[model samples]
Target chain A: MHVGIVTQTYQAKIYVTLRPSVLDPAGTAVQTGFKQLGYDNVGPIRIGKYIELTVSADDEDAASQQVDRMCDQLLANPVIENYRFDLQLAPTAGAAK
Target chain B: MHVGIVTQTYQAKIYVTLRPSVLDPAGTAVQTGFKQLGYDNVGPIRIGKYIELTVSADDEDAASQQVDRMCDQLLANPVIENYRFDLQLAPTAGAAK
Candidate 1:
């Protein structure tokens, strides 16, 4: 039985931000709401969606190609939102690492 | 100059939920906070981290395997947090699909 794992990793340092000159009404609303709730330390809260996936495959290569295609096609909006992804493969049986 | 796009796709349905029997103080607090903010429709807001990545790979296979290893090794917490990832590959040169 072959197993494969798909994982997406985002450190706290990663942030989703709007273009400098662009206006962000949603972000502004969240910021105001946070202040009203007594969260003084909350700075400009730039919110972005984070998504990770796990997939099983016969060959890791084929699986990877399919995944990349999904992104450019429908997942991330290249015009307003930019995203990055990482893939993790299960170890082979006979190979000793 | 081959480009491999690492993409993580998540639908709104994906949620991070605590075990039914387990105690979740964080969830409780958030729920209370939402109610106070006039979001009466907000149910239990389960918060989880979403991460996506983009890497340039020489070959799709090698890239896929390497990414899988990173996930089980570090990214997703197998114990409490579970994650799923989707990969999308860029089109190959001189190959019409």
Candidate 2:
């Protein structure tokens, strides 16, 4: 069986945020905490998404397209949060090539 | 055109680790950091994956199956690290139903 695992590799991303309009106490707390820690140079505490995922396709083009669709159809709530990410490809290990 | 972001929202998981045998300086640093924070009740700080995603499909079953395949073919590295996640579905906004 071709057992495998999916992570922040391949064709995806992980998004996090403060549920819409909900007070971001964590973000505010962190900002205050940072100030106390002597890092007063930070900008407005815009706490938002943390995205991670991996993609698999016959090639990169199709993977990108499908992943884009997946994102639109599901992953992110376009109204509230913003996201960023990194991509990586993991080569198969100990497998007959 | 429909545009979206595929985060750790649906049909996915994010697998993270210290890059296979690479010393986890951050994890070690965090463990120590936590101890200094007076949280001596913490464990070995086995830090790993953080996943968030959203899935949309005709329904749930097909999405789950396809996501499983996507993961096996790409998202994760079976050789190292560990994975976990959460799934949610976002309804269309400001659209005629």
lDDT of 1 by residue, A1-97 (tens): 8656533221111123344455667656755764575434323434454433333343456546544544445444667765555555433322212
Tens digit per residue, CA lDDT, model 2, A1-97: 7746322224344444545565666556655754575443322343444434344444455546654554444444656544344444535412211
Instruction: Name the weakest run of 10 consecutive residues (lDDT summed) in model 2 chain B.
Output: B88-97
DockQ of 2: 0.02
RMSD (Å) of each candidate, 1 decimal: 17.8, 18.6
lDDT of each: 0.43, 0.44
lDDT of 2 at A4: 65
Candidate 1's C-alpha runs over 4 A off are A1-22, A58-61, A90-97, B1-97
Using TM-score, give the best candidate's number: 1
Error of 1 at B82 (Å): 11
lDDT winner: 2
What is the TM-score of model 2 when looking only at chain B?
Answer: 0.52
Q: TM-score of the candidate numbered 2?
A: 0.35
Evaluated on CA atoms against the true complex, candidate 1 attains a DockQ of 0.04
TM-score of each: 0.37, 0.35
Clashes of 2: 28
Candidate 1 global CA lDDT score: 0.43
